[model samples]
Target: MKIFMKILGIAILIAIGVGFYFRLNDDVLTGDRIIGIAVLTSAFILMPVFLYVRWKGKRLKDYTLSEENLKKMRDKGID
Candidate 1:
């Protein structure tokens, strides 16, 4: 499922790029309108799905500066 979402997100991003490229060349008003809609749809779908797949099963606490983590950071001289 994660792999599928990743692929879908990549595909949508590519589609948006292609649509934008065509949009620059299109002179017809309706053609530009279609490209605009396609780009917006790709963006809306790409963000959430990609983020979900990227962050799925990851703990937010592990990345935060809790007491234990802060101590480790201090030990490493990274803080």
Candidate 2:
């Protein structure tokens, strides 16, 4: 439940970011409406993946996939 809320929050922020980006430059943009919508849709969709990768990368710096980390107990030995 907490993870779901976090993801939802991330998604809303991304949506606002994308909306602001487009709103600011809408006048300069030139293309068919269909093409424009397609671009925006894909870009919005990509934001979540980008965020996930960023989050995972940050977590990786402080953690590892070794057996010790997997067990998540300080007393456990990797071997």
Question: What is the Cα-based TM-score of model 1?
Answer: 0.63
The Cα error of candidate 2 at residue 54, in Å, is 27
lDDT of 2 at 61: 36
Candidate 2 regions exceeding 4 Å error are 27-79
- Name every residue pair that clashes in candidate 2: none
lDDT of 1 by residue, 14-60 (tens): 66666666667764565566567656765787567777778999999
Query: What is the C-alpha lDDT profile of model 2 across 30-73, one tens digit per residue?
Result: 32343455456556755565666568637563576776566665
C-alpha TM-score for every candidate: 0.63, 0.34
lDDT score of residue 1 within candidate 2? 41
**Candidate with the greatest TM-score versus the true structure:** 1
